[model samples]
Target: MTQLETAMAILMKVFDQYAAADGKTSSLSKAEVKTLLEKELPQLIKQAKNKEDVDKLIKSLDFNGDAEVDFEEFVVLVAALTCSCHGRQGKK
Candidate 1:
C-alpha cells in the first residue's frame, strides 16, 4: 500500500482497537476517547493546559451531539492535528 493508504489503515485499526473497549465497535465513548488520547497521543495530552481543555476537545469533536465519536468525527480530530503539525513544520 502507499504511505497514505497505510496511514489510513492504521487510523482505522487504532480507532477500532480503542472503540472496542466497551463492546462497541461503531463509536468511541468518552472513556474510550480519553484512554485513546492518553495512550496514543500522550504528547498532545501532555500539552493540554488542564483536564478541562481535554474535556472541551472531546465536546468539540462531537459535532453531531451524539455523545459518542464515530469514525468520521475521529478523522476530523486526526486531520486537524495533522494540519496543525504540518503548519508548524512549514513555519520552522
Candidate 2:
C-alpha cells in the first residue's frame, strides 16, 4: 500500500479505538468524527462541532498542507502521545 493508504488506515484505527471506547465509531467518516466529539470528547470536540472543523484538523496535521494527512504526519500526530517510551524498544 502507498503511504497515503497507510496513513488513512492508522487514522481509522485511532479513530475507531477512541470512538468505540470513548465515543462512537460506527461511522468513521467526517460526520462520525463530529459525532464522536459531540458524544465523547465534549471538551475538545466542542471546538469541532462540524465537518469543516474536522477537515481543518486534517489539514492542520497534514504538515505539507497537502489537505490530506499522510502517514508521516499521521504517525507524528497519532503516535506522539502513544508509546510509553520513545527510544525504548523492548517490552515493558
Estimate, for each residue in 1-92, the C-alpha lDDT of model 1 and write its tens digit: 99999999999999999999999999999999999999999999999999999999999999999999999999999988998988863454
Candidate 2 C-alpha RMSD relative to the actual structure: 10.2
Off by over 4 Å in 1: 88-92
TM-scores vs. true structure, each candidate: 0.93, 0.34
lDDT of 2 by residue, 1-92 (tens): 99989967867776666446435434233444446446554655566578677667645665675443344554564454344346544456
Clashing pairs in 2: none
lDDT score, candidate 1, position 11: 100
Measured by lDDT, the strongest candidate is 1
* lDDT for position 26 in model 2: 42
